[model samples]
Target: MLIVKNIKNTIKYFIIILAISLSLSIQTLKAQEVAIKDIYFHTDISFEFSDTFGADRYNHFHEGTDIMGEQMAPLYAAVDGVVSYMVNPEGSWGYAITIKGSDDYTYHYLHINNDTPGTDDGNGGIKNAYAEGIERGVSVKRGQLIGYMGDSGNAESVGHHLHFEIRKPNNEPINPYNSLLAALNSEEYNPEIAKELSGTINDDKNIVSSSESLCESNTLIKMADYSTVYYCGADSKRYIFPNEKIFYSWYDDFSDVVILGVKEMEAIPLGGNVTYKPGSRMIKMQTSSKVYVVERGGTLRWVQSTSVAENMYGEKWNTYIDDLPDSLFFDYNIGEEIVST
Candidate 1:
């Protein structure tokens, strides 16, 4: 009887292990089904978003996928869908396109030159469609030639590339890279991608070859808080500047906290010549445009006010000190606040 009981116990353990293994295999297969639209060589051109964008702050999460391509690389429709709504709200997206997929998801294409030809009913094609929509005000369809690629709108500083976003039925953005994994023939390139830069200083110098080769040696610099400063030349090679004391910090991804000043220093006005305290913590960029008073005692808290030096994305900050002064300075100015607040 004891021998029989031992046999049954072993079988039960084997079944449990089998179940766990099967579950993991199913998840892996699901991951493999993601489709990849285009396979561009990954270069440290400074803006390839990863699947795990905010791992350090909020554990792990990503919003979109960026395809590396030339200025006007044609973006094909990943799947058939109807045009939903198109808007050039702030001209930040240059000319933008939005499509609703059969899967009840909406795909957004931002930073296009203008609508593609043959989109409208002929009176106004892509141009008229947007114009009419703006006049009459309505959402527009899939497969419509919304616009061509151009370095327009807010992404002007960055190189000309398409900013594609996938949203669920409820409009939550998902990582575009993962969405295309299953549909492509080539395996996803997980190796580090880089760009090369090399040029000589000369007046009207004749060039032989503009680009050399894309390799893995491209050094990446994450410039937030107070990281490192990199210099790029016409040669396209990036050389790191050492001995520069840059500062960066890690904070909660969803925290609306802004650093007012170095710990124990009086709040400085915007545009005023200022200096940091001995132990000041330089502030990182955030999403909102308001200057906030954050008092850090045993717990950290923030009070939003109007006292902002500049406005970004149409958000204005202009108020006065309402909270008690605390230690640490946040240097998140220069009009690049993260907009997840």
Candidate 2:
């Protein structure tokens, strides 16, 4: 009887362990599916938008992005989804359509064109507004053309453009300017799924990276006996400078890197890479031509126009550019494009 009781207890413990393992596996799969690298947003269009866009009403704020494009320009599905809502005639949203993606994100395409192609008569009707066979409950694939830009609803006099909005599963809005840019430059390579650590006491612990240098920075540090430089962030972790360009972007010279023993450095752990300082320099991936300026934190804002760049940084603005390594692109997040000086 005791043997049987022990056997039953062991089986129960084994079942519990299996259940925990299954739960972890499920969570990992979900994380992979929702990673930022896997997400896509554009089918075929290039337009400007800003997360700071505040197209406010008398009392309401902008809940979606206003994508500046030509009147009657083609509009495509931002994701693979089923059309959930459509409003014709003239409401506040004008001719609008909403798609609910399988990822649980809701894509709102509002203020679609409702006027004649060349006039703002507001009589284009459903045929001019929606794509063929597009209606509520219809399935649509990403980049599939479903409508045209319009001056419908409250935007009758404002201009012709598509007001695109992305809503989370809870229906809250996400600032989609960056995501739209990502979709616009869809050919850009995605970051690796696995990244190796940059700084740690490797097998040759005595000489870190074969050199140690000091610099002027807010919170820079390094192993007292080694040469690799790190930025001691306010978050209490050390971040690698990666290269001289990144180092000089934040400081002029190595006159201030705090040195501590390996024992002291190990206590801080590793944070990541120290991004270029805001307003210090412009950057672009070695493989891409898009120039960007560093904003506060790791936000990378595109230098949208040559004139804007020259106006802000001078006629020799191109000289300020630095080639950011593509592998390190994931270290920063794209922000609103700099359209004006």
Best by TM-score: 2
Backbone clashes, candidate 2: 9
* Strongest candidate by lDDT: 2
lDDT at residue 151 of model 1 (Cα atoms): 45
Number of backbone-clashing residue pairs for each candidate, in the order shown: 47, 9
- Cα lDDT of model 2 by residue, 277-309, tens digit: 666678999999999877434667787789888
lDDT of 1 by residue, 1-341 (tens): 99999999999999999888766754443343244333222211223445541222232233455554444333433445666666534353456667666777777767654433322211222432232122212333211223334444665566566666767788856556654443232221110110011111100011111133221122222224544333222233333322222211111232332222232112211121111111112222244333332111111122222212122112322222122222223321222222222
- Computed on alpha carbons, the lDDT of every model, listed in order, comes to 0.36, 0.67
Give candidate 2 misplaced runs (Cα > 4 Å): 1-44, 53-57, 89-92, 188-341
